[model samples]
Target chain A: MKKTTQTPPSSGASKESQMLAMVNRRFFLRSAGIAATTGAFILGACKDHDLDPDMTVDLGSGDIGILNYAYALEQLEAAYYTQVIATPYAGMSAMEMSILTDIRDHEIIHREFFKAALGSSAIPGLEVNFSSVNFNDRASVLGVAKVFEDTGVSAYNGAGKLIADAGYLLLAGKIVSVEARHAAIIRDLLNPNSADFAGDDITDSNGLDLAKSPDMVLPAVAPFITTMISGNNLPK
Target chain B: MNIFKIIDEIQKVDGDAVDRLEYATRRSFLTKFSRNLSAAAVPAVMATIVNKAYAQSPAAIDVLNFALTLEYLEDEFYKMGNAASGLIPSMYQTVFRQIGKHEDQHVKFLAGALGAQAVAKPTFDFSAGGAFPNPFSNFDTFVFLSHAFEDTGVRAYKGQAGNLINDPALLEYALQIHSVEARHAAKARAILSEIRGNADIKPWITLNEGSPAQVYAGDDNTVQGGVDINGIAGKSKEAITEAFDEPLTKDEVLAIASLFIV
Candidate 1:
């Protein structure tokens, strides 16, 4: 059966209720005129900010760990894409420019999505040091692009099973699909003759896909990533 | 196309009129009419419903062992593959070396998770019953084995996802490694297919745009046309789309392990 419609909240009703709740006899007895002013002042402080401190930097655990894990990758991807867009490679094709731009947007969306979704559990905006990368050179950009995309795809594939919530799994799948597309495009850029773009990276003899735990992936990603990011709080 | 269709259907379910109706249009007459329409439609939809249960099997003792076994297989394959001096492209030598280390790490990690009390790691044959008797003899064997090994690892990881969900920590770590293995698999396929100018890396067992074991024969590029995954009720896809990998039963995985295990 279809569910009933949810009731919508009236604008500022909740705020008005709180303001009145502060007007008890204790307020009149405490400091008369100043109590009313103090109550209003306290209400003003309760307003929420765009950047919540509780969510800006997560310490890792359960869903927070996963969010932080995703947050770190988003930071890396966003930085790379930002560089790509800021300085397109020499002789960059329109298609390449357009696709890379779209990829950049997607990465930003993903980064922001994690931020919004995690709310109070999101990690702080990470500091990604990709200073060694030369964005103007096609080969250099593509090489790093290949590594980053491949790494992203691997990261997703390895983390899928750890999620118990199907909702989260579905979200991860959506992101992974996009990441795979990015990997394919990057691989194609590296070598048009290379069938690398349209291939499987982690399969086995009986035609099974390989998965690894974060404990394994972090050490590998650690060398490339200069900063030490913790995901210890991700659900065990 | 499938995704578009699904979204389209969802939009239809939400009804265009409902979206078009602004908050200001919540008058008595329109609200009553809409409410009646929804009430009428609900019963019709409810009457034909069949409650299908997608009952999932919990992680079996055997599936874990199966995963450990696959890990062993990949661990051995990479060790041997890396040992081949001229086999790897000079440009990709560093890539392969790093991949080898990653695979070793995966094996060790799984070994640790499984613990000493966990099932023993399977000993791989590395030979597919003389199908490719001398894999080390030539580049073709290397290519074939590499492709096969990587493909198998991808599926194996996918197959075990359900079983490991109960162990959140282990599952999380396993997923991290799974992604690395996928990269390795893709890399291996790219190298092999590029050498032959085939340009196609979709395995014979994968179908339905690489969903693996879900499409028709002519639809995919598999050499075998199509092969049903035992215990799993579907045909392998063209390249094994990253969508859903078939879950393997404990018995099914153990049976495969027995073939290679000493």
Candidate 2:
């Protein structure tokens, strides 16, 4: 079935240009020797609060911790998809573009939702390092997309119990299914008609999807994130 | 007079009501009645009560059994589809095989968890009483039913989350199953699109997908937590629908599953 060419409303806003500007500003700030000082100052401030300066950010405790945890992952996804659309993969079909753009918007909305919900407790904008990913190659991009989406679904699943608040659990449930949808699409794009959709690695013999705790998940995504996330205060 | 208070008052009045009668029986009756009352309306409140009802949360076990029943149906569906000769396309045989294995594993895992409490798998009629006959013999019929079953399974797992909330480990496990079911749903839809040459099919559920509307019911919802998601900047109904999947109630889920269960 051929998908329609309708793009999400924000697709027209030129997020790529904004992302480039942000990158350039970061470059300028670093070259001026101000970035380290700013980082040090933030660390010092955190120390005054009895927070560990060694860790980039502590996710806090209880429901707030869970929300921040979700926020951090959503930030990674939004950044990754934003980059994907910014530099479309070679030989990408219009259908691929449309669906991926939809996924991009969904992740951004999820990221923004957690940000809004957490308010002051939310972690700062996470800097991502996607140097390992080849954005121009469809296989490379889709392969990464599959990992992110599957990881995202499992992360949310694992964290559901950490959220004591029923409202937050419900919210997590809402988002994970969408992530699953993204996972399926990315798998299909990489190898259509392959069993990759419910691959044995991510899913167990019982057909249940894998669930990884923050301790397990944070390290897997660590390479892509420049900011060190400490799940120290999060619920065990 | 409050019925619960009256039950207490009866013990005070006769003083022998507790000694002479079976306390366990009376208490069980009260708990069941209260739960039934709660289940009548306001699902969010009912969910909280159900989850918190721990010593009473054998109710949770009941929920697990319900999940196992659905898993059994799905496992058999995929296994049968894979076994049917010349039914599934050559290109798609491996996909069905993998899905079938997962479903079989799901059945085993759930049954293992339930142990002696696990319910036996019921006989399933894939054709829904001749609604669509010879499903195993027709690839199109099989594909369409597969989509329905996968989607139903996703919702079925989601519907039970509230019931399992008191058990954090179990709740997380159920959530894990829920997402896999969703992945299965997406894959089935994608395959259907490929076979039909319909480019309009999306991996995610859209507002309008035509026929079998029950699958998409409540999916078009835009209002969540007293906020219209569409009211947010750069958001629309379509985007809102795509953002969050709606959960089916247990009754709603059973009604759908019953179509296949004899």
Candidate 3:
């Protein structure tokens, strides 16, 4: 779960901005070089974003659109877990700490994987608003974690049909189950020795977990981020 | 409300529409059966069209039947385990009961969806010809098998997502059930870890480490989408493997399931 890549094999062996460049690369570019070209675009958007916070970031069309949709969610998850680990809640057990730490790495890896796969088509790093989350309190942090993990599973489940490529469908399948596992572990932590791991609320009497459409999933996660994500171009 | 009237509307759009319906309806074509049918018959006739429209395609039917076979195994396995006195420890009975309930529902749901096409539940030898001599009698052995079944279910459902692609509704249902199995599997792994006092057996599969090693084949792979992602974002190799669950093809899954099938 330890996440530190002092140097990417591909990115330049440049000066002090390596740290800044790494973060920028994840949020803004496919590689360190692409950052220069997308740089102006990012700055203009930043000023426009400052003026109009409601301008939507459109998830493009076709498989790229679906990939971007997924990329966006991974960004949110990676950011959240990164924050959770950076500022651990009070009285966090060794077991809980380890579990959350693994989840954080998985999410970041997921985020980076999509970014790498999407290449230039990937959406920029989303601005998160975690004012609603209380990182110091275990209950509050876990509550948000539960919601995020469960929502992630539902989003992937629902988005399967929108994926036109068989490879992409299988890839989405690869990621969702891991999210479900993360969700189960977090739920177990909240209520030990209970069936809340596959609780009745997220799953139905038919025993199927929730499969929600992008429209349904987008709004649920909207509160967690300050940036607007317009899923209008996403495949139905 | 009126079959002929609806056909007339359709004919206005395309002169040969009724002929195509007569041919396209396949098993439910009504014109061949009753040429003098009245409007009252529209209700009955239209119902057949609606039903056939939702009927599973050949691909989906195969996947659903395969899924049904797996669900039947899980439902029966858990039922027997939960019913066995003093088999599941008092502390973990509730967890087993809940899992057993979900498997039961999965069986009924899948069988109901398949209806006449549903495959009969195979006679399962939980003992696997003495491979698992005391599946129900031994609590630890039972937990181990439980983990295997749940994990297999997740992989099995996932492998068939592409087959169900043409049928969106079926694909969605498969996904919904797939993740539920994952939830059950994670809990089972955690319980097994507790039973054996092994922290190495984490909720997520750590580099294909688990009993019934075949199920975890291809799991140690850090490559995804033809790219070596071991060091992506600087995460450890274990995290890379744990981040994604690999799918087992239908043939692969059935071979594993056949161990218990008589």
Best candidate according to TM-score: 3
User: Judged by DockQ cut-offs, is candidate 3 incorrect, acceptable, medium or high?
Assistant: acceptable
Clashing pairs in 2: A1-B198, A1-B199, A2-B198, A2-B199, A2-B200, A3-B199, A205-B105, A206-B105, A206-B106
TM-score of each: 0.46, 0.77, 0.81
Question: For model 1, how does the per-residue alpha-carbon lDDT over B137-193 read when each residue is reduced to its tens digit?
Answer: 466677666655555555455455555554443344445545445556556655565
Q: Give the lowest summed-lDDT range of ten residues in model 1 chain A.
A: A35-44
Per-residue error for B40 in candidate 1, Å, reads 64
lDDT of 3 by residue, B8-28 (tens): 221232323323322343332
Give the per-residue lDDT digits (tens) of candidate 2, residues B25-76.
2333344346546555645544543333332245556666677777888888
Worst 10 contiguous positions by lDDT, candidate 2 chain B? B1-10
Candidate 3 chain B: worst-modelled 10 consecutive residues by lDDT:
B1-10
lDDT of 3: 0.78
In angstroms, the error of model 2 at B144 is: 1.1
Q: Is candidate 2 or candidate 3 better by lDDT?
A: 3
